[model samples]
Target chain A: MSADFATCYPLKRGRAHEVCGPGATYFAATCCNFSDKPVLWVCPSWQQEMLNPEGFAAYCDPARLLLARAASQIDLLAVSEEALRSGTVGLVVTEIFEPLSLTHGRRLQLAAEAGRTTGLILMPEGMGSNATETRWRCTPLAAGGDSTLQCWELIKNKSGTFTDWVTRWDAAARRIIVVSKTGERPRVARTAG
Target chain B: MRARPVDAPFALTAKESNTDRIQCLNTRAERAGLSRGMTLSDARALRPDLITRPADTPGDAGFLRVLARWAGRYCPWVGLEDADGLVLDVTGSTHLFGGETGLIADMRVRLMRAGLETRIGLGDSRGAAWALAHFGEGVAPPQQPLQALAELPVAALRLDPKLGIGLERLGLRSIADLTATPRAPLARRFGNGLLLRLDQALGTQPEPVVPLADPPQYGVRLTLPDPIGLLEDVTAGTARLLAQLCDKLKTRNQGARVLQLTLRRVDQGSQQVELRLARPMNDPVSILPLFERGLSGVEAGYGIDQLRLSATRVEDLAPTQIASAIRQSQTEDVAALITRIGTRIGLENVQRMLPADSHIPERSFILAAAAFSEAAPNWPPRRARPLRLFPPEPVAGAGPVPPVRFRWRRMALRVAAQSGPERLAPEWWLEDENWRRGLRDYWRVETAQGRRLWMFHTPQQPGWYVQGEFA
Candidate 1:
């Protein structure tokens, strides 16, 4: 990637980015790293108890994270929309068990735009269809020593071509480092024409 | 006062138990030489176009309470004088309508228009005011309460009727006659109440009026001409009340934190729904929807005759800054969002993190209620901590040294890499059961299976346990 696109991942303000797989939370946390403002975490009430504040401190300040627990999936979506519309929050991350409909995604996008905030939806793997600007599937790889490796497949992008990248999440340093330019699978050789 | 027939003379009667009597007589009925408190049969003999109605004592009391609340517009301090009267403390408020005389006149006219007969009194003391309103000549506030009260009848002191008759038998037909007698004898004869009443009316003794609490600060009430039972009607009423309530809040520069909607049914029973906000707000548009959800639970059985919206909790609302358009919009949006979500879920469940003062990993941060607390502006610089921590789970591995392999949660994990043992001692000043192991040596271990686990070894117990995991 060139320097121009190095810092930016096509994640624009007022847009929704869908991250799926076991490493979704980690990827969403990394996306949240773009802004220094407060972030809203909207999830199910049961999920809230399992959330470890120490983990989020890696990407965003713990004090900057506000937790909103919803009793149901509908409430979760509503809370995310509300938080996105609230211009005060820089980022809104929602955990949904089911894929959001196109209308709901569009509404979230509009609200995010109006508030000048970003929204990240964390959903289960393979639940692909969404209105988000970009969708990435992340899978946690075996650790190489102390650092955890993750492979992200950019399955859909509204502004760019499909690509893949291998990255290392350094827990101690609390930073994400691109590990390789090639995709996770070995590159196929071709004869020169 | 006479409860006369509307058009013609009628033999009317009021029944209390078995003793039926002519409680009130009309002009023509009285002209037939009939008097009040006469037996119903005697009134029947006079002329028989008889009609009677039972006196509604509870209805009268309810009307009196309504009147008292209505009087709050005139003065914030209003008290019920009796079942039939309302007392308003218009000390400073009278000037708003011009003066005491003007205020009284205005109130009289308004009450008359509302189909109520009213008499107002003003005095330096409550006792003096009560005496003047009930017994003295209908005059302006007296310059000298004692002199003005001296000419009134003895009953004007608000004495028991039997006591008044006894005083009259003793030649004390008027207050002047009672005042002329020696104080000691008067007290001994009529009991101490007479002198106390006299002193209180004369302004020598204190007679403080316990004014009713000011009407709900952000409340607006609407009494319908006809009862409504439909949900839409209730919502419409709520919207109307919210607009009025918001206007009141705007004037006072305050916002409601909790609101209560009372629906008074025609059956004389009332149902109330309370809505709590995550943030204080005065905007009616945002407030109405919250009431909409709460309205579902309110039973509008029969039909609702009155709807009252009251802000039970209020806080001073500071003006929003317009310096930075973007910042202002964001702040307002966030606040509004918080309020809306809070109403739907609950305010207590919304939480924000605050940095706590402690070196212990678990004690380093605490979750505080978002509505009551503010985010800690300066959190301590980040240190290496696991992404997730669970209650210490025992690991089937032993040693002061790193274990080559371990079994946790039915999974076998071979340690591929390991970090140092960061020693942390128990906080001596505090008693924690989890920390009873005295001291712990923590290690960051990366397993071959890609899981990074935080394991701790308590030297005293000689066992290793997985305490947290890094995402």
Candidate 2:
């Protein structure tokens, strides 16, 4: 499962990855930027909130992302799992309000491994699972004017290691890059003019 | 249309004005003295165990057309007789079935085999056939059609009920009574419609039975040697049928837009499963799963002996276009996946965000059902848009400028950094209720506690609202 996506980044392909806390959806969308294949985003049908194409365009093409709304949590997971199992979608992202059980996480992991597709599980609160390839926490940082700057903490890397970085979406380059190193408490730091 | 044994009390009720009334009843209900136009509750009181179903009038019309096609085996010309009957012009074609008697015998046997009752009539004209089918019995001889029709009731002329009642009140109980009266007075009172009908019945005026246009049928049926009730067996049967139907469609270069699968049970009852395609699909590999999804958990009561798959709606799939679609097979696969997922959670639930031609943030993009839309290669040029945008939730803030501190989504925070009073004017031509406050000055505000929010203030209304978030 430790198929390196990027050398320094705490992420991998063909496995389950968890992104929690503030800006988790944005981080999930950012993760999809790595693949050119179409993304399947699974969410609850009742939710009125959705990704803004204008903002999502800065990271990944909104056109590439297919939104699947399921009426229930089980359906949401089932859709994500099925999409992952199909191996057709480049990335499968699911927004789960309930905690992902260990068995469900393993099944998703196996599904991702079998299909060779990247899986991003978004949650409001973090309960890092053993079956997860990596668990990360994303918090909104200083610059929120024109562009988004966020502090990303790699809480649980696959190799039992920890790494953290302040990142910002570089619009012209169309990629998120590390802005600076941050300790326990993140301080406001300007990365761009 | 499901087949019901004539012995079973079955009635199709229809909403008539204010009350549900029996539109059509089978022999069982009729034997119980339940008649058409009778209130359903009265019929229910007469026969408590009556199997009642609301009639689908349009569906019955469609079924009548199908019945006409079935009757085509007897004669070439088959025209619909109102809603519940069919008129077949078997003028010369009757010889193929040995004669009028033999043709009728064959029709009766076939319709009865299909669990339907038939009251057929062979006559010299369309009106004579219709009248005999409804009010009289046996074929009316062509040379003496008037003599046969004279005994029938006046209502059999297919005149409006009001006219029939008016004629009946005047002591014209039969066609014989109407003809015995003076033609000029009858013409003045009842008008020429009655005469036209009378003439058409007696073979004086021409009445053509215009046959229905037979469209290129894209259907395949497989009757099993052994009836199947298991889902696996049904799935296998569906796959075989799919392969055959796809081959049929492929040769004609047509793709099914809507498919209906009818599984006829041994007990004469039937169940139907329908699949609507997001795109025209000819491949069995792509279409089979959708059918499986549609057919899963469908009750196969008494085991299904016959499986008929018909493409109720089809679209042209030219060879060149199919070749091009295959070249972009990745998209083809995605479309297939969408159809599969759509079968589970509904097609409308799967969506793709498409950038619209609008400056309004909410109207800038639309979530269109992925199955119904083709994905664009790229979006419109990136603007400063929030990561998540929802309906503007009113915040406790005021004035044209961004408030120094405000509450949103139940969180209160002071504004740390503020950007833009980006004046976005409403589209004057389009009346939008939300935009009724008029010009809004948007501000990208960062809260002191580290939350990015897109807030707007209306100059005309003097109120602020939070519309979106960066995260």
TM-score for chain A, candidates 1 onward in order:
0.84, 0.86
lDDT (Cα, tens digit) per residue for candidate 1, span B1-471: 234325555544667689888765555777877887888877777767655555566777787788888888888788888666777777778789888778778888997777555566677777777777877634434557766677788888888989999998988887778778899988888789989998877777987667776544567899999999888989998999899999989888889988998889999999988888767788898778767667887787889999988999999877766677677655556566666678677876678878778877777778787877777767776566776666888887777866999898787898888896998888999999899887889898887876678899999878898887776
Error of model 1, residue A60, in angstroms: 1.9
Distance from true location, Cα of B294 in model 1, Å: 3.6
> What lDDT does the true structure give each of the candidates?
0.77, 0.84
- Model 2 in CAPRI terms: which quality? acceptable
**Which is the leading candidate under TM-score?**
2
lDDT of 2 by residue, A69-178 (tens): 99987888888888898888999989888888898899999999999999999887755467888888888876645557887777877765676777887778867777
Native-contact fraction for each model?
0.55, 0.75
Q: Candidate 1, residue B200: CA error in Å? A: 16
Residue-wise C-alpha lDDT for candidate 1, range A6-33, written one tens digit per residue: 5346367888788887577777777766
TM-score of 2: 0.66
